[model samples]
Target: MLGMSTTTGHGHGHTHDGINWAERLGHLQAIDALDRDTHADVAQRLAAGLPEGATVVDIGSGAGGMSSAFGRALAAAGGGTVVLVDAVPALLDAATAHVRAEAPAVEVVSVLADAADPALPELVPAGDLVWASGVVHHLPDQQRGVNTLARMVRPGGRLALREGGLATQCLPWDVGIGTPGLQGRLLAARESWFERMRADMPDVVRLPGGWGRALAAAGLGDVTSLGFLVDHPAPASAPARESVVNWLTFMADMAGEWLSEEDRATVARLIDPHDSAFVGNSDDVFVLSASTVHHGTRPVPPA
Candidate 1:
């Protein structure tokens, strides 16, 4: 699960709820770096059918790693504009620099706005392709969020949302420490914690059906979904190992209260570098995950 952290101000990483945005940024950067190739592939797939010099908008754009990848793809497709929108000015600044440095030919525009804001469509330009990764789920009114994104898609253009997939799996079912199936238990706790998080959100509204259906409900056409695999086999790279550890640490921390005392201790031991059970110390550690993207296109008006 992606950590939920709010970016309410500059240099102030904590929201009123006490979630640390800076720490979350570090984790996001690590994951982005580790999954660079996979992200690039996804970008290429999204960019392939775009018209030349198309305008692409990235909603809830984090450190701009994915936006940079999109810039690279756009550059390959003969240059375009990428509008990076996020609530955090710092993140937008970082993303602007990253996009410019990585895809200098592509124009970069940063919009400081929250994804949940009703005025988002007015603040941001209509996009030839709009992308929101791990964003819509955080909104209290998910359908309204999708509807707002849909409004930004120019006719005949597409809106791509990266949401829902199997959780990342790093360690084996039995880690040979604490209890067997530690990861399984952690996942269960995470589900409970997720429900609580949603309930805690202001004005939370529940919607049924998967993202594809949601897109259709939002008046988009030809909705389709695809899954991308992120697999790092045995003898994982140092970055992959680092990512795995960070991911587990974030999960453990977020769902700690729901986790059993033994499970919490097991997690601490696994992430502790000084401990022999540290995941980083193991040569067998690997990162495996699958992310899904739902695509829906704005219908062209009949002649």
Candidate 2:
């Protein structure tokens, strides 16, 4: 699941268009751990057929999990550079260290700059592959951000944007403790909350025609959209269980107000580790999430 920026009274903390790294480091780290394998798979597919020393850029790289995954893939492709860009300095530092430690064979660079910055291309060099996962939605002007990223892809190189897909579904539809359709209600509330969050963003601009058209409008060719699934069946791993707990806690905190009192109480009990009905402790608890990546290539000039 992607990190979202919103103002909330939730103790977890928040930042404008980014996670509050100092306060929510544990939450971010847990998510990275849960998504590590899926991220590596995406990296492998994206890194295929690249030249020996390809340059890959990861925009809005958080905790460097995806960036490091890209680094490892690049290393396997011979050798290359993985540039990590983010607005948060701490995240940038963490990602830099993580990439270096995880993919020592590949060169790593970090740039602390907002994705919406018009001058971003001046700071980061063109990339063989530009990757931005769960990032464009944070910008006030999404298409402008996509255009900026497109500018960073060298001719013939690709730009991949990981955006919409089905939200994670961990608890069963009938989780005995809550109402029969607690998960459905929660998803509804989350959607409403998300709409409000986007509207509240400063200078927010509506993105018409979705990401695929956005990529095409950016002057990229051969646009493609693909989805990657992260599925952990019943008896989920410790990290997956923990990630589910964290996610529920976040939703309960951030969207609790929109939920009915009964639903809110149910969520509270579900996330409480000590509760006998805690969802994470259930043998039936599972994890399922799908992330869609939109790809476009900067067309090579005709001979």
Best by lDDT: 1
The residue-by-residue lDDT of candidate 1 on 1-303, one tens digit each, is 111112222222222223554557777888888888998999999888899898889987888888989999988888888888877666667777777888888877777777887778888888999999988887888999999999999999999999999987888888889989887888888898878878888888897989999999999999998899999987998998898789788888888898889989999999999999999878887888898999999998899
Overall lDDT per candidate, in order of appearance: 0.84, 0.83
Residues 193-278 of candidate 2 have per-residue lDDT tens digits of 87888888888899998899999999999999888999989888887888888888888876888999999998888889999888
TM-score of predicted model 1? 0.93
Q: Pick the candidate with the highest TM-score.
A: 1
Please give the lDDT score for candidate 1. 0.84
Error of 1 at 169 (Å): 0.5
Candidate 1: which pairs clash?
A: none
Candidate 2 Cα misplacement greater than 4 A, ranges: 1-22
- Which whole-number lDDT from 0 to 100 does residue 297 have in model 1? 99
